[model samples]
Target chain A: MSNDIQDLKQPLAKANAGLDSVHVFAPATVANVVCGFDVLGFAVNEPGDEVVMRRTNKPGISISKITGDNGRLPMDPAKNTVSVSVEHYLKSVGRLDVGVDIELHKKMPIGSGLGSSSASTVAGLYAIKTLLGDDSNPAKLLPFAMKGEELACGHGHADNVAPALFGGFVLIRSYEPLDVVRLPHPKDLWCAIVFPDVDVPTREARQIIRNKINMKDAVTQWGNIAGLVSGLFMQDIDLIGRSMQDVLVEPVRSMLIPDFYEMRKMAMDLGAVSFGISGSGPSVFAFTRDEQTARLITGKLKQHLNSIKIGANTYVSTINDAGPRVIG
Target chain B: MSNDIQDLKQPLAKANAGLDSVHVFAPATVANVVCGFDVLGFAVNEPGDEVVMRRTNKPGISISKITGDNGRLPMDPAKNTVSVSVEHYLKSVGRLDVGVDIELHKKMPIGSGLGSSSASTVAGLYAIKTLLGDDSNPAKLLPFAMKGEELACGHGHADNVAPALFGGFVLIRSYEPLDVVRLPHPKDLWCAIVFPDVDVPTREARQIIRNKINMKDAVTQWGNIAGLVSGLFMQDIDLIGRSMQDVLVEPVRSMLIPDFYEMRKMAMDLGAVSFGISGSGPSVFAFTRDEQTARLITGKLKQHLNSIKIGANTYVSTINDAGPRVIG
Candidate 1:
């Protein structure tokens, strides 16, 4: 509409023409890998987040344009998870004096339990690092993004943060500053996630569960979590199948998802190792050893949801190798 | 001594002979695996338990004789951990009509944190099962052994039972019946265990720790447990290293061990990826990738303990593929 606005568009075009600021694609992730409850995640290889960041003299992070968030994502850089992380990371490494403008293409659905929000935050921070010429490795970049994530999620839970920082299965090293560990992800594994047509706010769903767990139950939960992680790392299919059980969060949260019970039952009957509420709720994920089983599990879950007349979207993604990426 | 005592000595002519009735051996195990505390354990190939069982006209399970207990262990059949589990397992399965005579060879040191008591109970039950001639699978015998464990450890904990029953690295599936799931232990891994000469009674050690855990810490604990198990399953050395850290149990238990703070530092400095308190206390275990690292960690741990003049035994072992075996 104006000459200045049009000029802004020209810089964007030139930046897309293979500049130093390159495009990287980071995938959507699944957090709270079943038994892990609040501290495990895996970045998927497909259907991810794209960020476009360019160097600037503005002395602060700027979200030039926001798309794919239903236009509700904040353009004001200070309030954004991605911008805040980038700023914090830069400042911590004594480079906050520089600045960048990041254009976010938040392709994944918000609050979808597919780690849509975390993916964006991870991508944004990574894009800023590339734009600002920070060659810091993933381990170095983790804390900065985790701090930003605390702002977004309202709690410093690393179930999402660890995977978002480093692809594959992730372990929370420590919670204070969000130290993280990237566990080995399966080389030949794919995930089938079903996003039901529903909404269960993470905060609201989390509050519905009891604050205290019986010591007996707590010990069992920890043992199962250990078993689940061991199953993943050992590539022990039967062990993984059994370890996917979670007694702490799933029973309480599954009540929020319409027909969650029926879907879970049918999926297991159709050969899913296990099924549980994803993140807060309204989404559920299952593990399969091969593509056929994955597809079969997905179909079984969908049929149950459909019989109850609930709409949902299913995704087939391999374990995520790249967490956050950039695009023009 | 008497003519009957002389007869008993002459008949056991075969050095490792298994009696026609039953001969049971339960492998020594490392429980807790650091962050898992009361809920994780794995059987090792070394330091096993040996029990010989024979059919008797007695109305109930009876402990006829005990060797290597240093005159300290209980003689009452119903009160002992091993005998109790066998009785409970048999009673629960509706075979209360049967009777047995158990001879426990307490080869492993009592209160060693190598699950000597559990090994005793498991070995006793195994010997009884062998005598029964029903050829029972592991699932059938779990209840009997678990009940026996409850008698000794106060609360029936699985960090020991699961590994002894199934062998190798194991995850406790549930506590009710003490259900268990065996995990795939990595081929290249080795554990260097340091058994401090000092004693930390399991009962007293458990009491010193806090009974309640905050939800935040609980989440982190479970997260790390899952990560550690995943690391073992995937054979992801990095994840295993990262997940081996503890926030719940170690922080408190470490205070009880003298110079534990410094010992851990020395172990880590010796290239061990992770070091943690074994079971209740005193014994410490370090995880490494290769034999060379294992030796290094063992040497370092011994040296540190000695520097503080804390006498201890150090051992390096791979994950034992073989669990309980026949004595013949």
Candidate 2:
């Protein structure tokens, strides 16, 4: 649908045309939730990414600024997940001619295994959708967000992006058909997250995991997965804690994070419901039932890391139920 | 708490001692439900076993008669699972001196992969518990029933015995702690079961399965497991049907069952919700939303087997909610 110059200008000249700009915030997410490997994830309230978008008369999308990345994120529009995803979305909706300038603010740490890129990409996609007045169901935007994930990581897994986009816990039951099922969780569930200043590359972290696992271990893992889903539906917190065990990836991936077991023991002893690596490595999370315990866990965990001469950042919040939203 | 001989006689002579005899019927079960191998199972209403137990003056348990087994079952009390489980129960409760004679009536086919042994063993346990006037929680008898499973098969897996004892759908989340969680299912759900007259030894079926599996397949299996559990909780019938897929066991075990894929296709075409090999199979089952569909499925499946000159027994029933009951 090629539009003449006069026709393209007519819509923007109207009194109530689409907004001139949009600002959106998308929350960070914890992927590979314990027993759920590549299948499950949940969103949190704090430590999110921010995106600012402005419509222009110019032809294509471009990255105006990238902050908090410490020169790590790519500046090229084709190389960055945010612009690439926005381009995919624009092309899908036949709005490629509509120009936009994107600014990604990485409020969360990059490569900390806390879905940092997913948050930014989701924020950018949401901003563009709002700018173009596409009010279709947010789920329709999932594939475009997934393209961003594929660009950031080699594999286009939705465990992180689904929750970051949909809010709450989401299960990617099948990737070929892109079946994402939203799961119920306890209302009072709290998460205490900590990112220790230890470098663990996502590519290398994924490479260390075994390609094959014992059948007995697979049975145990699936049983725990069943129990975890059952616990969420039944709202049984204790069962959820008991079922959050991982036999396949954690054993090998934990080696990448320093003092992982020690931190886990400390968290468990302090009455955390369950503790494990958030995403791949470095970042760890503790599930708790109350805000007081969540804050207490983060406090003690930060102290332990400091005692070991390691710097860390911590956050405590309940599960996020609303995904990306407009701020201005 | 040693009872003197004269004291035991005094109690027997009292007006209200223990019952002279009791008879119980325990329902058959389908273990390794699709994606949930070694973890999930559900009980059926028909094709179960009956057991009759009588008090005797002799101070030891004995099997007086074994019927319907085609001269295959053992008569020795120590060798039979029914009597062995009874002996364990008696010892655990300090009732070793109590005497009982057992009669095993195999109402269902043996070695049919439909939990035939589990039914008889559970029936015998229930009968003994009733005759001795021990009206405790039925779950306390699981370990003793598991002993019966160990006698029947080399492994002490609880997938078969758990549903037979607990009734409905059961999940054995952990084996070491013996954690069993009962799950809810739709009230209108029905099962169409077919037992083909073929031999697939449980030991050989187990041996054919690979000791190790690809991690990617494990993830897919667990994703389906989680989805199935969630569907059960949410009472979503369509989701349940979609998630009832097994990637690990079905691919290998299906080779042992004749016309497995054809039967599955026929069932699905007939509007059955899901179809899979029951237990290790030779026996297979189809889940349906209504009794009419279930009956239709079984009728068609039986005719197909007959056309192929293969003998089969077909049944249609809803899930059994009661584990075991005294007949007289």
The model with the greatest lDDT is 2
**Residue-wise C-alpha lDDT for candidate 2, range B1-328, written one tens digit per residue:** 1232223333233423568999899999999999999999999998899999999997899999999999899999989999999998777776788899999999888888889989998998888777877655777778888889999988888898889998999999989777789999989899999998889989899999999899999999999999888888888889899899999999999999889999999999999999998999889999999999999999988889888988999989899989999988
Reference-based lDDT, residue A324, model 1: 67
lDDT string, candidate 2, A1-328, tens digits: 1223223333433423568899999999999998999999999999899999999889798888999999899889989999999998777666667899988899888989999999998999899878876656777778889999999999888999999999999989888767789999999999999999989988999999999899999999999999999889889999999999998899999998888999999999999999999999789999999999989989999999999999999999999999999998
Q: lDDT of model 1 at residue A187?
A: 71
DockQ of each: 0.43, 0.76
lDDT of 1 by residue, A3-94 (tens): 32233333333443324454556677777777777777777776677887777765777878878889777778778888888777666555
TM-score of chain B of each: 0.85, 0.94
DockQ of 2: 0.76
- Please give the lDDT score at residue B310 for candidate 2: 89
* Cα-based lDDT at residue A244, candidate 1: 77
Question: What's the C-alpha lDDT at position B225 in model 2?
Answer: 91
